[model samples]
Target chain A: MLDRDEDILKAAESWAEVDKGVALATVIETWGSAPRPAGSNLVVNEDGTFLGSVSGGCVEGAVVTEALDVISSGAPRMLEFGVADETAWTVGLSCGGRIRVFVEKVV
Target chain B: MKLATLSAINTERAARRPVIVVTDIGNGEQRLVRAADIARDPLHIELERHLRMGKSSVIEVEGRELFLNVYAPTAKLVIIGAVHISQALAPLARSLGYDVTVVDPRSAFASPERFPDVRLIAEWPDVALPPLNIDHYTAFVAVTHDPKIDDPALLHALERDCFYIGALGSRNTHGQRAVRLRAEGVSEASIERIHAPIGLEIGAISPSEIAVAIMAEITAQLRLPKASTA
Candidate 1:
């Protein structure tokens, strides 16, 4: 629950210290029974490591897995998570919620 | 960069200028000072106030007049109910950047065991509220319809000018409460400040849905211009 600007700056500061490229993911929208609200944040490092979350353990593993791709590619990407997704079966939540996450690298 | 921005915001807030502190990520350990004037700076400045609320306020560069309004991120929501609605509300408000505290007089309901990571106040409002210092930035909601509990808290909230005062009740119940307040000589304007029917007209039935509607209304009110909206 950090604010949008604060989370980005924190990621940048931490990345600067470790000399790792930082990628940020934000939940811009959500559907029924979503665990986190819009504006939820997650920060990822080049090593495929991350801090914070965009879902309640339901979609984070996928997000982190994709975030690593965003960091390596250095390109902003948008991801979707929900019951309709074929990979949704992998995570535990079955409550039928959808979330849209926007990922970008902070320079 | 941080010190200068903090100083700028401090001066503005001390001079009664409205400013907002923007912080990022979880745990709220990082922040930047943001204002109409300060936002023009090249480097982002994170402004953080002591959580102690109302103590020493320091702005450096002695003897210069700067009009600044330092807003403390988002105001807090203090709820006096532990029902299912609160279960949805605590996390929602936290996401919206409000420091949320849920209080229930019943020890069975108020325990931290039930509400993980949420600040729970087991004491009654009269006892618990003073330390919290409910102010203009604070919004209070009393979901428990019990007069013994909600009434005393309502009185305290009205007296303290807590910004948004609300209670969960029907039109009939709120009407009766209004009558009681009038009999006690509380002004009509003051009684009107309470969002009696509570949430917006979303026809919410479930507790979580009700929570969403209430939060949406509060958020809308918080964003509106004070004089125009009132």
Candidate 2:
């Protein structure tokens, strides 16, 4: 249950309470053979430690890098990844799916 | 996505109360909705629908894309017996993500060896169930057959408004149980909710099959919408 959505949110809250720069990434839309459903959360701290998944490790590394930038910038970002998209070249979803993730700092 | 909002959502979840975090994905504007306040919200019907299904989805409202992230408590299964059927039922329910607990007052019947990794409580229902906070999210089953154990547990389950309350018995036995419960002052409406002769009509003949049947029924109750007059 530690990896469940509830626990992931709990980690976000605890990380933020301790003054750590925390960012939350959530899958807001998906199509084709998407691995995770909408509302799947990925919580990341300033140290790049993350819990949960949005694309089942297919795009988590890229999302974490973007999340770190979001944490520092304090600005939200909307990210889109599809098998046919330009950004898919480096971190392609092997499942051949499309997912839109919203990343925001947990201020 | 404020920290205060995140903390509040966690508090409601820890209390086993359903909560929703509505995020307007267009701008990252967010709002938290508690269970008691769902009715007054503008999107009450859609909110209740997702909450009941324990699902999260994106919906468009007035051209704004909102993600309704429903945070429902983990569903629990309280088995009032550690009988043969429960041995199978506990593991099956756990596989479906239910926090399964087996209760029986008989020490010999409620042993750790029989129910591995399950929350085994070798105490009477009156002693064991209250602390579990059997809420609307819980699915309660009384499979002990002994009136002394099953009856009280069932009464408590009804009182707590458990989404599913089932008792393992034949129709004939259910008839007798009806009389006993009526005598104990349980209203007719409450008694009608119990799925006596528990489980789906799967024509199950074995203990494992019966467990499957019961779990199937529970899944429907948790996920499917009720027949609506509206």
Candidate 3:
């Protein structure tokens, strides 16, 4: 049966197939405030990926890391990034928000 | 790598997902179109209008040589309890086009005898969830207040990354439950994932009303563009 995540991933997959080799990222959890709620997803590919804004770009770098990891390992991971961190200044998100993402290889 | 699975419901194949497009027809415009088929296409166009407005509906599409309607499939709901609220929730969730599953460890409660058409599981979450492979597409609700049962299921859900994790309890129960979960080594952030007192504040006093509130919250959680549950 096609569940919502599967449907989103399917949508992302078709979008990527027309456009190829994209990385798929899913918002598994979120804290405080975020642009997308959990279960929302986006795909990133070699040239450029879908900018679904899982964490409003606040944690896209962390997600890119995990997306690349999935591309290489075929293993999925859950990632978390937020404004309440020493490195928050570098991340440029100061809204006291956090997002957890699960990146998986979308074949 | 999950391959996309599509419902074979479309009348014609498109290079991409087809969007229902409708063109208004004047009173004397194309009366040659069949009475039955005329409404089909126009209604589908109206459906597309609903979809564009952020409402879900079935719509018709019309192009030079093509005519059809697109129906986006609905989401699913997986409930981890066979409690009273769940009994009421199962049909409601199903009515919303959400595939529903009700899980419970107590055989007396989870038995198919009680929930005839519902997917009822008679095992603990550790035994059940692994096989189910709860994913982000799924919503996990723990209605059984028993910590021994609901906790392990929630752990599996957290690990599997279910989209929604709601537990039924009062303010006092949730506080102590948080302490227990913290003691179990669940991270502060992961512990925060739960939506305790599981339903919205609607002065719900009946099991059915509570079910409505929970489904409403789930709908809200699912619709939000970004997911932040703190």
TM-score of chain A of each: 0.83, 0.95, 0.70
TM-scores, one per candidate: 0.53, 0.94, 0.50
lDDT of 2 by residue, A1-107 (tens): 52378889898998898999999998888989999988789999999999999999999999999999999999899999988988897898989999999999999
Q: What shift in Å separates residue B217 of candidate 3 from its native position after superposition?
A: 0.1
Q: In candidate 2, what are the lDDT values of residues B101-182, reduced to their tens digit?
A: 9999998999999998999999999999999998888999999999999999988998987989999999999999999999
Per-residue alpha-carbon lDDT of model 1 for B1-230, expressed as tens digits? Answer: 13334344445544434454333222112244344445564332322222213111222223431111234444789998777788888888888778899887888888776678889998888888788878767878988777777877888888876768888899999999888878877888889889988888799998888888889778767765455556
Q: Please, what are the lDDT tens digits per residue for candidate 3 over residues B1-230?
A: 33332222222122222233221211111111221243365454444444323332212235331212222234557788788888899999988767788878889999887787998878888887787766655778888888888888888887866668888899899899889888888898988888988978899989999999998888777655443434
- Give the Å shift of residue B61 in candidate 1: 26
Per-candidate clash tally: 19, 0, 13
> Which TM-score value belongs to model 1?
0.53
Residue B213 miss distance in model 1 (angstroms): 1.2
Better of 1 and 2 by lDDT: 2
Chain A accuracy of model 2 expressed as TM-score: 0.95
Q: Give the docking tier of candidate 1.
A: incorrect
Please give the lDDT score for candidate 3: 0.63
- Model 2 clashing residue pairs (backbone): none
- For model 2, the docking class works out as medium
Q: What's the distance in Å from true for residue B101, model 1?
A: 0.7
Instruction: Provide DockQ values for all models, in the order shown.
Output: 0.05, 0.65, 0.11
